[model samples]
Target: MTARALSARSLLRWLSLLALAAGCHVAPIAAQELIAHPSAEIATLTRNEARLYFTLRLKTWPNGRLAKVFVLPDNHPIHQRFTNEILGLYPYQLRRVWDRQIFSGTGQAPITVDDEQEMIQRVATTPGAIGYAAVPNEHPDLRVLQVR
Candidate 1:
């Protein structure tokens, strides 16, 4: 190949490596996708608080209500995205936490839903549930939970 072509390829490779280091590929879902029940007191959670909840470490909301967390199946893209971007965890890492919780008997795994629709339905009807969807929702009973 020409020297110019080789130089351009090198630049591209360097830029892609920089993007990986900066965690650039987590697609930003619109604010409406991460949802909770309308009655849930939480409107927003900082990253640490979200991690605590998803890891099953924080079981209750600040108001003494059990935070019933729901999630799409691990194979679902929405599940992967939410876990990676919002919770700052990979699916397997989250599963390890859940597996330990199950075998150790000191904690519990989040309820798994089959799809975004079920996630929305379950979270909307379950009173204190939290989950994610791929797209913005218009359910009257659901409220979007913001992440800081």
Candidate 2:
């Protein structure tokens, strides 16, 4: 092959490899869903309202019940997905909001569960409780909240 032809082929091969590498690192869109106790009076929330609940800014349900919030640890994959995909916020931003609330003595952080199982159990048993998980419908005791 001519030297020019060889160089062009090499460049094409490098570009193909680079594109594959970039595609491998791209994150898949998460499928996390917001869940609540089966008895929770609220069925749907605006995205802003859901954000407020997770941030500890909104304290009560529309039915006048205290809104109990549960969460997985900050570093858990499901928690990260929930914060990023559902709430449209990073985990650190949520932590900062909670920390400020605690330091200011005006609010408290959500109850942190160990894993998805515990998250489901807590939300199912705790009245007015809300949380997020993958496939929340699998548990009949938990209600999936629609975020509009």
Candidate 3:
């Protein structure tokens, strides 16, 4: 091959590598901005607290208030992702797990709503309420609890 062609190819490779490295560096901040959900000042929760809140185990906050929880529809993508990735259970398996839990009558599950907006609105309107929603949809009305 000619020297000019080889030099052009090397330059292209270097540019591609630089772009990739830059992207890698910028990715985390972008992801945080995208995924991070902020809550109202009074609605803040620690990671462990958030987990307990979501599981229907903690019926009340540490402050002696009832902990109401709003959840997404069964078929929501976020619900699927959360159950599979975070809870380590698939939909069918999750059903079985819930069934077992229900049979024992340990506690009630979070109230499932149709969409993020509905969950957010319900949580906002209801006292001592918490809910799941996409970070983008999070608003001043609803508070997001951090999941440990």
**lDDT-sorted candidate list, best first:** 2, 1, 3
lDDT by residue (tens digit), candidate 1, 70-143:
98788888888888667767899999999999899989999987887788889989977878877877889888
- Give the best candidate by lDDT: 2
TM-score of each: 0.77, 0.78, 0.58
For model 3, residues 1-148, the per-residue Cα lDDT tens digits are: 3586568657856776887978853222111111111223344455445555566666765567776766676788867766543443455654564566678887666677887567666777877776555454446555444333
For model 2, residues 8-111, the per-residue Cα lDDT tens digits are: 65885677678788885422246578999866777789989999988878888888788899999999988888886677678999999999998999899999
Clashes of 2: 0
Better of 1 and 3 by TM-score: 1
RMSD of each: 8.7, 11.7, 11.6
Look at candidate 2 and tell me the lDDT of residue 128: 90
